[model samples]
Target: MLKIVKTEILKLKRYHILWAGIALMLLSVMLTLFTSMANDGSVWDFTYMIEQVIKNNMSTIFPMCITLITGYIITREQKDNTLKNILTIPISFKQLLVGKLLVCGILSLFLGMICTIFTIMGSFLAGFPGFSVGLALQAFIQITFVNLFLYIAVMPIVILTSRFSSGFLIGVIVAFVYGYCGMFAAGDMKLANLVSVKK
Candidate 1:
């Protein structure tokens, strides 16, 4: 299982999937920055900026990013013509799927860290009022974990998409809606924090 996971992670080293996540992170921060122009008199601080990045990640970016990345990795087994070779080694498709999913879970954390890095860069670049070393460190931890949970929340769609060759795009759509629905559930005490708490 660890070997399968290692293989899956190696595949990602050649794939540019992280670029998509980075792009989305930048866009999320930019969108938040654009909204800040409304000037409602809210103080912009490192923590506040982190919140905006988290909001965009939970509601817009992380879901589709992780799903699409996972789906592509899964499907590439067939596309790259390696599935047959892998099966000959006595590794079942089920095992392969599990390994790929596990790798994606790890990938989600890496992407979360990337998102946090980009958010901090965006904050400093835009020169939004408040920033302190302590605030930045706290925000990094908070935002990164939030994004990791956001990926976990969209796991079902990732699994669903992995079952088909042409499901990546569909998975992206489903993930977006699923992530967007987090907003509705977030207000309910029962469902709020469900993403972070559930598997």
Candidate 2:
């Protein structure tokens, strides 16, 4: 199990997925900073600003990025035909799948923490009140837990897609479509409420 997990981590070392995750974190930070500045530090109450930022940005970005990474993690192995080799190495399929999930999930959580830290610092530097280290940690924990659950829920779908075709593109498309549908449905509901309000 340990060896399989380590191997999975090593495989991800040179992948563009890590860099993409970092870029997403940076982008989230920049957006949060801009919003804080624009609000003149008054939009969200200080105590809740960090929580709001985490809820808004991480909930959306983290899941999408993790789903992409998870797809690539499995699909890349299939692409190179290395999955068969790995499977022959005495590792159970469950171990291999769970190991990969752990490594990818941890990486995703690390990225989330980076974004959380940036938000906390940016909020403070912007002179937003109610910045608490404890609260920031709480928000981080909340977001990470939610992301972990989402990753688990989506893992089987990703694995199934990869097993079918060994096609990273297809896996990515499927994951994105799944996520997009959920988000779109939520947005449609919100819009319906607005339309009803104006009626």
Candidate 3:
């Protein structure tokens, strides 16, 4: 398992997927800081500010990052025509898929936790005036749980896409559309409302 994880990490070195998470974390922190500063220190209008921060960051960032990473993980081997070689190795298909999913899920969850921690720390540093360590920890736990659930929910789709998709681009498009678009379409009737409004 350690070897599999290490190999996966090495594979990520050539990809922008890992960096996307870091960039998003930095961007979220900057946004939070700017928002607080721009408000002239009067943005304390909620009891769960840290929780709000986590939600805002995750909702805005996680979908795209997770999709890109997961999509690439599913498609990279196909793009390089290495899946055949990988399959011939002494590993079960289930193990390969599960190992990849576990590694990617851990990476995503770790990034999410780091972002949440930074947000809370940034809030405190910006003198937001209501920084509770307990609240911050709670927010972290909640965001981590959400991240894990999202990862598990999407893992099967990724594996299925990998098994059947003919090309990298097709796989990526399918994964992104299904993972992100389907999510919005299922939850937000606003898209339908907007279409009807336009009509």
Candidate 4:
């Protein structure tokens, strides 16, 4: 399983879809910056900017981005006609899927870190105040953990969709709408509390 996971990671080294995920992470931060330009009378600071970016990521970017990337990676073996070779190594399809899922969990954390970096860079570009080491640390933890958990939430979708040919693309669309629905969900106090930790 470890070897399989390692091989899966290696397969992503020169993958173009990986870059698209990174770009989407950056786009989340950029969207936050654009919102900062609005005269909504809300003061933007490093912490607030981070919150906004996190919101954007959860509702708009990370779900679809991670889904698209993970789906492609998982299905690529079959698409490239390499699944048979993998199966010849005494591994069942279920074991191969578990390995891929584990790798995607790691990928989620990696993309989270990438999003955090882009968040900080976006903060610098926007010149938001109240920056501190503590805030940066908090942002990193929040963003990374949120992304990992988010991936877990979307795992069933990936698993179900990967069974069909070109189903990941459908999964991508479903994930986008599924994620975007969170914004509406947050509007109701009961639903919001159910979905978020109460401070």
Best-fitting candidate, measured by TM-score? 4
How many backbone clashes can be found in candidate 2? 0
lDDT of 2: 0.65
TM-score of each candidate? 0.90, 0.73, 0.68, 0.94
Which window of 10 residues has the lowest lDDT sum in candidate 1?
190-199
* Candidate 1, 107-164: lDDT as tens digits: 8778777777888888888788788888888877887787777766778778877778
Q: Which candidate number has the best lDDT?
A: 4
Candidate 4 residue-wise lDDT, 1-199, digit = tens: 8998998889889678988988999899989999999998999999999899888989889889889988998899889899889899999999989998999899999999999999898898888999898999999999998999888877888999999769999999988887887787776887665444211
Could you tell me which 10 consecutive residues in candidate 4 have the lowest summed lDDT? 190-199
List per-prediction Cα lDDT, in the order shown. 0.80, 0.65, 0.63, 0.87
Per model, how many backbone clashes are there? 0, 0, 0, 0
Candidate 3 lDDT at 99 equals 72
- Model 4 residue 77 distance off true place after TM-score fit, in angstroms: 0.7
Give the Cα-based TM-score of candidate 4 against the true structure: 0.94
Ranking by lDDT: 4, 1, 2, 3
**lDDT against true structure, model 3:** 0.63
Q: Candidate 1: give the clashing pairs.
A: none
RMSD to the native, candidate 3?
A: 5.9
